[model samples]
Target: MLATYPIAATEQNWISATLLGALRISLETLQEGNAPPEFDEALSEEYREDFLRGPKFKKAYDLFIAKCRPLTVDQRAQVLTALNEQNNFPGVFTSTTPCCSIKDAFPDVHSAANELFKHAFEKLSEWKTPGCEQTIRAKYHQLVDAHLSHGSCPFCGYEPLEAADPDLVDPDLDHYLAVSIYPFAGVNLRNLTVMGDKCNRSYKGAQDILLDEHSARVDCFDPYGAEQVKLSLEGTRILSGPGEGPAWVIHFDPDIKSRNWRRVFKLETRLRANVLERHYKKWIEHFVSYAQRHGFDITSTDGAIDAVARFKETCEFDSYPAIGRLKTCFFELVEAALNDPMTVDRMRNFLVESA
Candidate 1:
């Protein structure tokens, strides 16, 4: 669990402005007229500057921090109270009606509001010391394993009925942006979360749900006008900008399954071999062949072998993109085992080994 820092002076204003801007846009889109093109451009610029943490935003943040620190105790207390009030301001997409999931209720939004908050928060992760990574990851894992191993989704207070049985699932490094997209959030380490593979796979994706003109909707819950959280599972199965009702399992790929290798490889031995083999076979086959032709050990010393593995770890905040191409391969293997029915043994192997 990443410790959440309360929003300070500038961040509080940024979050409030971002949320208000998104609300304004969503309402404008719902009016009986065409949406202004400038709406998206303006929103994008705000997102780029505030949510993306660009240079201008950095300078502004420094000024805000400097001003906030010298506040008297009463002043600081007032800021803290305002931040807590913001929390109860009716979180966007809180509806749980059967015909309407949160996404279904909010249509016409460009992105998920919560995701914006998460991205903003993720910027803070860069300042954390080394122990923060392990601390957060371990806490996330503990919450997930408790539920998966015991038949629940602990973080959100959800549980799988025995009849549902989950067929297959694992603790996934989930961007809460996709699962429970909240506005004013920036998808930071604090907002990063864990969830069952089923929830991430079954419910979320890149589009807003269908909105009927007949049904009365709230501005905060509107998806089309809201800052949308684009869901990308398996690099496909995407819905965008007021399309589908919810995600349907439309595609599955075996090659991306890491647990497949687990069936044939132990944690230390076969896992590396299989990931390396997949990396060579899928991505760098041509380059590797050419390199071998020239007598260069590019596959070995070049770090291509562990590229995908490294990525898998870093996707959980372990490392950087410059290290290699490890994450893609590792993702594939994990996805493979997760989606494949026949790969139960492989999945089990992973659960035990990882545990």
Candidate 2:
């Protein structure tokens, strides 16, 4: 990931709190050998009547209880414990260290628990508070606005993330722990974050953040509290083989978190297709025009080098920098190209032509 977003101050509202409370009560009641009907009665006695009236909540609760009925007493206890731990968003997400896998966490009942939570998450849209006006979905948008107000998508630092507006569509609320696997954290605010469509759907769709395909633990950045990871293109070079003009190597910090982030988002491949290949020539053209307008003589290699350095400085220090890391690295690449005597004339020619 290119940047980290600020953790939202908003706490889970009555909807989430009530659902979690009900789930816990249901799990505890089942572990004690209580039947499904008794679990229903228990929820009715605890939560408000209006909140429990919805068919959505009823269906979710009924399905969850039915799924739990097949589990052994030991399995039930394990599921309950996993749910509680996963719900503690702070404990689960405060660091880059990998947590236990769902299979290990819940042992024999992970599949059943995953389905139950998936159904429950789907039903969250229909669960409502008696006196509260905003739905949980609306609160999700508010969280998006809170974090996105700082800048672009925190995952890639490439696309812009817009706040929720009536006239505009809201960004995707990506489940950091994908619901298909870690459904225990489906509705946890810390697990949900706004991501660009490409990053969420195209790249990281349902990929597990905590474990690799072989189910090994992998270090992952905490979207809310992680420090920004840096990228360096100094080692990147234009390819020499056939079909290689836009093809070049991409480099990121050689840290486990960075490697995990790259693998999860396919960052290097994306950077090549989306940024370097697509924008390199356009950026160079724009730079030449910018230099000409600023009275730089692009005809001279020294002048081109100076302009490239100045552009890199501007990008490095700009407020609300767009693709700041990639831009800085790109300018450095241009500067290096300018310094190469073999490439300098070609670079100068392109700059003069672009001007």
- Where model 1 places Cα greater than 4 Å from the true spot, the runs are 1-138, 147-182, 188-193, 206-355
Q: For candidate 2, give the lDDT.
A: 0.67
lDDT of 1 by residue, 1-355 (tens): 0011122211213343554454444334333244422323435464444434454333333333333344444543443333233333224324332222323333222133343444444443233223344233343344444433434332222323132223433245444433243333333333334543444455433222222133432232221122321112343221212433212221212222322211211222321343333332333343334334555432232333233233344343322221122334335554454445665344334333322
lDDT of each: 0.34, 0.67
lDDT of 2 by residue, 272-347 (tens): 7877777777777768777978888879988988888877787764333335567778778778878998878876
For the record, the alpha-carbon RMSD of candidate 1 to the native fold, in angstroms, is 20.5
Instruction: Identify the runs in model 2 with alpha carbons over 4 angstroms from their true place.
Output: 33-47, 88-133, 238-247, 316-322, 337-350
